[model samples]
Target: MERTGTEPVTARSALGLRLVLAAVYTPLFVLGAVVFSLWAASAGPGSVPSGDGLAVVAGVCAALAVLAAVDLVVVVRRRRRERGGRG
Candidate 1:
């Protein structure tokens, strides 16, 4: 059967995608935070790590989180609109 735009994507599918992205990104972010924190803790009184590596990883994970959040918001809004129409 041919699919059309009128059909909504399932909530489980949307949530699964969001959760998968979150699961993948959360660890990377936490790892980067830990490494950066440890490096900072070990540094001299007036020094920080060069931080380039940590910054890159954190940036990537932050970007992924933002995208996932946007996707989740869109999915939730769509679901709400669908339900509102049905009532």
Candidate 2:
């Protein structure tokens, strides 16, 4: 195909890539938060000394996961709009 300036150039979609990454990592983050929360909850008087630090970890992980999920949703919506809202 001869190069023509009139042709629409289709570049690789970084937004799509970001969406995939966010979607994939969101669940992992959520899982980590859940596991850490469970671990913090399981601490007993006879068990290792309880620390508020563990709960902090869980909260941070959960917050990051939610942000990632929101990012994924935003990217998906933007991509759809770029595609003329076909989706």
- TM-score of model 2 vs. true structure: 0.74
In candidate 2, stretches whose alpha carbon ends up further than 4 angstroms from where it belongs are 1-13, 45-50
lDDT of 2 by residue, 1-87 (tens): 355566557735589689889989999999989988998898765556464667788899999999999998889888888788865
User: By TM-score, who's the top model here?
Assistant: 2
Q: What is the per-residue lDDT of model 1 for residues 28-70, given as tens digits with 9 covering 90 to 100?
A: 6656656665664555653544455545555665666566566
Clashing pairs in 1: none
lDDT (C-alpha, whole model) for all candidates = 0.58, 0.83
Q: Which stretches of candidate 1 lie over 4 Å from their true place?
A: 1-50, 85-87
How high is the lDDT of residue 59 in model 1?
Answer: 65
Clash count, one per candidate: 0, 0
lDDT of 1: 0.58
